[model samples]
Target chain A: MDDEVIICRCEEVTKGEILKAIEQGAKTITGIKIRTRAGMGLCQGRTCGRLIARLLAERTAQVLEEIPPATVRPPVRATKMENLVTSHGE
Target chain B: MVNKADAVVIGGGVIGNSIAYYLAKYGVDTLLIERKDLAAGTSGACDGFIFLQSKKPGFDLRLALESTRLYENLADELSYDIEYRKCGGMILIETEEQLKAIIELVDGQRKTGLDVKLMRIPQELEPILSGHIIGATHSPLDAQVNPFKVVLGFAQGAKRKGAQILTHMEVQAIRTRTVRGELKVDSVITERGEIKTNTVINAAGVHAPVIAKMVGLDLPIIPRRGQVLVTEPLPDLVTSLLVDAEYITLKLAPDHRGTDGLGLGFTLEQTASGNLLIGSTREFVGYDRRTTYHGIKAITQNVLRIAPALKEVNIIRSFAGLRPYTPDGLPILGKLRGVEGFIVAAGHEGDGIALAPITGKLIAELVVKGKPSISLDEFGLERFK
Candidate 1:
């Protein structure tokens, strides 16, 4: 984990932050997601999810397949708050 | 010397990457050819929602369920983050008609052993949703991931396991041969040169139909365009993924404004970045990936009705991608009837991101071991015939 590199841009989470989370007892994939917000950033973890998962595996001495994959929810893009309000006005 | 391999997988989206990863993990010599970078198609553009609730009953639901399970373990197996979150999912019901439709969907889900429940009042939706809600149905198993990272992670893992990935390599044609009067796929003619291989897997996303046509196969795949909008970062306002059943119905409805023979559905998801994802419009505009104001407005209207607080969120950008749709709303997988060593793994439409893991695993198993761990007859190309 690089000290200068940021893992999650939205949360300012870094690779060190994620590795630390794993070291501190984040076992499940979601546990790491919550503690470090590694995969929770904009770009929706599209850039960092696999990277974090690899780091977690290295820290936990676990097989990659044993660690569950992240779940995907839809609207797969972000909607405008204005759009939500305006559409309802109709 | 040009290396020979057991399989050559075209396309490097989640499907192609996943197939390559699994095949290599199984110790098969595999070569993955991509026209551009990984996840360059719909996999790069759309939200990675591994949803099972909205699938049609029977075979579709069954396939989605199995795919969901595979997603659960993909992160560990691939050693990639993939941002997999099972924050659950909700379908908001604004009208009684929508509620009734949801009930039917719930019934269908239950028949397939899925745990889907309908909320009679808005109180039961408290933990899952915020703001106004008429009624809603909840599914604990629904989840999301970042599409780009997942595909790249698979590509990385496949490469690590001895799979050769050629980026910026486009397949110009599929070369077939007559060995003792029997036709077979001999190799692929690419922009670089000819690579002779025993097996060819078409995981080409929207461009799959073109590849299939090269082999004299009719895939019945059409390009269904979907538009999406991205907003600037905000607080974590949405905990679970929120969907409006009306939107799904409207998207699926034939007469909906955005459904230009495709569908009209808008989904709202808040990313870890504090930004929100509003999507999308389904139109049958062939390979045109441009976004339109009309489509954005329709999607915005739908989002505002569910969460009025979103009125202040700043929209930064919007984009669109093409979903590879089939006539029966199912993807074409497995080998075509007459084409030996030629496999089809396209037409997943919007569900490509959701079903990538399972699709890849199944295709790898079918190609390497002669059969998939699961029965792929339902997803086979024969369904079209």
Candidate 2:
């Protein structure tokens, strides 16, 4: 069902590539993480960003706080290259 | 996969590497593609604030005071280390109707000469702001930099003055012809092929109306978005560049609300590594770069209503960017009247990174001087007809 569901657990990104990045227009969720890199791995989308914002508010009928949640950046966990060579006083 | 150029440009952010660094420093033959990479959009989700104390006095505060005097000599003319900071901004005035609409916007940016003032903010200036402010303005020519080192210092000064960036690619159309009856624009079909180039500069930010509808032109340029956050590296707490003087009348309409509807407030800055760059929220919400939970809870409940000691900082990250907007917040910039060799630099919604180097030296003096050292008929595109 929907290619074994799995919508982006650290970029496994499914639900059939978020319905093929919503048939190629995406409409948001940072346009399906720039079209399917899906919340960009390494827990960046914090576990599939509210399940791809509830599958883009149930495929656009719009609901869940009006679908909006992609655009999370930072070492939200995972950086240590000695914090990128000491950005300053660790 | 044929190529050729006299200009192609498209978009690589920081206004397509400052119009491919002044169209290869006037030698032309530039290229510059990029579908991603190079501040992958909205110049890597902004907040550098080269702010001119919130423009809007006329010709958008005289083209933001000539792009704040070209970022005070753009890091020694692009030797590149865009940490460019002059540190002096403030704004605040948290209501008495935002101190009477920020004293008529610091008296229309001090009659457009700008040295703002209005003072009385000091609690050691930023001992974590929020003394429940009643006033504040202090311009000192507002500044800050590092929009990914100003798009890698204008794509390394347009590839050491030869130009031709081409990352990831993907343009796809804008071929045009007509010849005797008029029309122009010769090539640029990209997904990685045809180049040709008669001169095509869209600077596709917020996908400039899908690259001006591949040359037929119907540009209102939408996608407004915004949203931002980042903290973790404290210690300085937030020195200069504050902003929230009702975000210049919520950037003069794009439905950027806040008559208590969470006015897309604040535009804070502070980086140079000390983090704290919270920001923005000017929805229209088309190219949704997300981060909404009411735009990051109205930017941390409006940055803890002016830093309630930043409720123990540590936001770390959040973003969203897209701001091509243009419903008269200015920025259309020349061309599109009968098309001819296409131009239009792109709508500068939130002032495209403080007007990317005077819109790449006025689109490289309108492609090596066809008239444009200033006088873009109020940035036409037939003022959106």
Candidate 3:
């Protein structure tokens, strides 16, 4: 597998970054987030959610279900400044 | 590029942005730096709760009161709409134990001159609230704001006042020097370059302790992870910031575990766009900011305890933030000994949005004028040592 393969496009996180995070004791998806910031982007982790999880699972020799997904936050999609600034604008 | 500033504030969340805004407003050459965009971390992840009712009755509540006062006209003053709302709050009492705690909580707040009512909440306030709740404590003073806008507004306002906000400029290290038998922060080394500043304010949120480490002062601030789920924008289900008594107790008391074994507390809020923002947990999982299946499941089931109609609601997103947890549950403010020109303004775990305004004003006052408008004696770093 190419280490350069992009995992989290929102943050430009790559498989190399994910692998490095895993090597640094990132046993969980949340752990990976803290280390590489893979899921802390615009889409919040929806796009790269499974790719990072599967990579973590493969490395740890654990089932995919064992590795949890990263936390998804508000404005699940790209939001305009107006929607974010004003209450009723959304 | 090399830049010199009178004060350099690290972190781009509400706290740092507020400090930058205040410092710039005070005519100080300030530089606000962030590793990510504004409100990208906990400020963006958590709900926009400018809550005062849940504050601990003494200095904490006083701080909330003062901050709320600052927020009253923040949108007008900033010339940017932050979506500030005093939509009120209702803390649900489920168990008899919760009832007693809330009674004491409200009594303490009332003694502090906060207008709060302890009774069966009228159906007009929140008809969707579960009938199973024994009672609720309602406070009109409770308010909220768009955390993102608050950060953005402060950033733009601060920029307009000539504060340089450098996003993606990560602080690599803290450069310090000894002059006249005193250790002082000489300059802040960042990924971009060096920022020579006499004063450095650590408003770095959950990453605060890591910043404190550079100065050799061990702050006992730990990052406590909290998760929240966002439901599709629905009709006005609840008008108030609805939370549980267990949530309040767990947040106020660190030693106490969940009233229920699941360790999940319900916080339901209806955003201006009509989305049901439900949250959260106080898991001590270090700096891992990911949403877990168990965490989401717990929040969903618990919120259902308050509003059964939510069982069918589709969750659009799930996210988490790392709360800057201190041992005593109080935020660390003011300067530390041995590190002159290094001020500590972080450790606001869950109440960062609520306390940002006051923190900014007090810290800025302490920096520029050498005396804060309010006494910060109790919140100083000496108590932690």
TM-score of chain A of each: 0.74, 0.36, 0.80
Off by over 4 Å in 1: A1-90, B122-132, B250-262
Model 3, TM vs. native: 0.82
Classify candidate 2 by CAPRI docking class. Answer: incorrect
DockQ of every candidate structure: 0.14, 0.07, 0.07
Per-residue lDDT over B130-241 for candidate 3, one digit per residue giving the tens place of the 0 to 100 score: 7887788888989988887788789889999999888756898998899999999999998778889999999998888889889998888888888887766677778789
Clashing pairs in 2: B95-B98, B258-B263
For model 2 the local lDDT of residue B195 reads: 83
Per-model CA lDDT versus the true structure: 0.76, 0.76, 0.82
Better of 2 and 3 by TM-score: 3
Q: Rank the candidates by TM-score, best first.
A: 3, 1, 2
lDDT of 1 by residue, B342-383 (tens): 998998888898888888888999987899988888887766
Task: Find the 10 residues in a row with the least total lDDT in model 2 chain B.
Answer: B254-263
TM-score of each: 0.80, 0.39, 0.82
Measured with C-alpha atoms, the lDDT of residue B291 in candidate 3 is: 75
